[model samples]
Target: MRTLTTRAKVAWAVITVVVLVWALLPVVSIIATSFKLPSQLNLGTFWPKTWTTTNYEQIFAGSAKDLFLPALRNSIGISLIATFVAVVLATLAAYAIARLDFRGKKLILTTALGVSIFPVISIVTPLFNLWRNIGLYDTWLGLIIPYLSLTLPISIWTLAAFFRQIPWELEQAAQVDGATSWQAFRKAIVPLAAPGVFTTALIAFFIAWNDFVYGISLTSTSAARPVPAALAFFTGASQFEEPTGAISAAAVVVTIPVVILVLLFQRQIVSGLTQGAVKG
Candidate 1:
């Protein structure tokens, strides 16, 4: 490998530092704000004058528990269900797309891409009315339905791309060793696709977890509302008070799962994304 010149190294280091500060400043601000006393909120200081855990306590121990806890449960339930369903369906569909010759394959891929980029707002109004009429509104299934719409397309595309990179010979070899088709697939194919499946599951979970539009628009109560929607409705300590600190605390709490997911699966995610980008 060729070494970078001194100037190039210096420039890259500067860029890295700038990007890190730019990305982390808002996150740091949220954490700092979450620890601030209500009286210290408007002090305009980056750090709290007197740190307190009141905001976090309010979310879990105070009146906000009714709203936050159920919403957290709904978020967990809905996101997991969506991720599981999307990955299973995508895996089968992607295997077909990657390994079989079928009519309309290109059309399916193109449509998937188009739907993934489709403006979600355009259909929200219609969906809202339909969901209301169909009795899915304010229900866990209601949110999961639309979340599949968001997650399925991307999951299919990513899994299809990953599947294309899997060598079919392994599957065939298993079959030659007297394994049935399903056995070969389950034992040979799925194991090789584990990384891709995991990465896709994480992506789908994030999509459903972070959703605000459908969560807020389709659900009216904590019954099925996720955290993002619940955060918007967080109340202050008093009628005259602002909910800024409490909201920050909830936001920080919500972010922990995403950070942990990324930390745990960083390598798999990177590998899944870059699988087909380079040809050997």
Candidate 2:
């Protein structure tokens, strides 16, 4: 590897620090806002004058609890379900693409790229009407299906790239040693692909978890509304006040699962990202 000169190193360091601050400033601001007392919002300070946990209490144990907790549960369930289904289906499709040199192999990757770039807004209105007619509107299944459309294409693309890099000899060796094709895949390929699979699942889950368009446009009630959507309905302490603090608290709470997942799986995530192919 080429070593950077002193001047180049300093420039890169400054760029890294600037990017970090740029990306993290909003998160830090929201966290600070979440800790502030309702009256301290417009105090024009980055940190609260009188820091308090009232916002957290409101979301967890007070008036907004009903809206926040149920939505949290819905977001978790729907995202997990979507991730699981997407990973399973994508794994199979990717394995086929990786091992088989059948027709349209390149076409599959091209289509996934196209679907990923397609505008999501264009489909929402049509989905809204279709769900209503099919009796799926405002239901967990309704949201989950839309989430799949957002997640599956990318999942397939990532896993296919990763799967292609895995040594074919491993699976072939297993099959030659009396293992069936399914056994070879389950016992050999799946174990080796765990990191990539897990990383893909986490990415898919985040996509579904953070979704607001489907969560807001498709669902009408707390029954199926995710946290992002539920934040819109938080009531204020009084008619004169906005629910900014409560909303901030709910946002912080919703972000915790994502943070924890990353912290716990950072190793696998980094490994997968580095080892997997970045493009079709």
Cα TM-score per model: 0.92, 0.89
The TM-score of predicted model 1 comes to 0.92
What lDDT is reached at residue 91 by model 1? Answer: 88
Query: Candidates' lDDT values, in order?
Result: 0.89, 0.88
Model 1, span 191-212: residue lDDT tens: 8888888888988888889899
lDDT by residue for model 2 (1-280), tens = 9999999999999999999899789988999999999987998899999989999999889988899999999999999999999999999899899889799988887888788877888879999999999999999999999898889987897788788778879989999999999999899987888877888898888889889989999999989999999988888989899899999999988887788898898886665555443643
Using lDDT, give the best candidate's number: 1
Candidate 1 Cα errors over 4 Å, as ranges: 1-9, 177-183, 271-280
Model 2 scores what on Cα lDDT? 0.88
Backbone N/Cα/C clashes per model: 0, 0
Query: Model 2, residue 15: displacement in angstroms?
Result: 4.0
Candidate 1: 10-residue stretch with minimal lDDT: 271-280
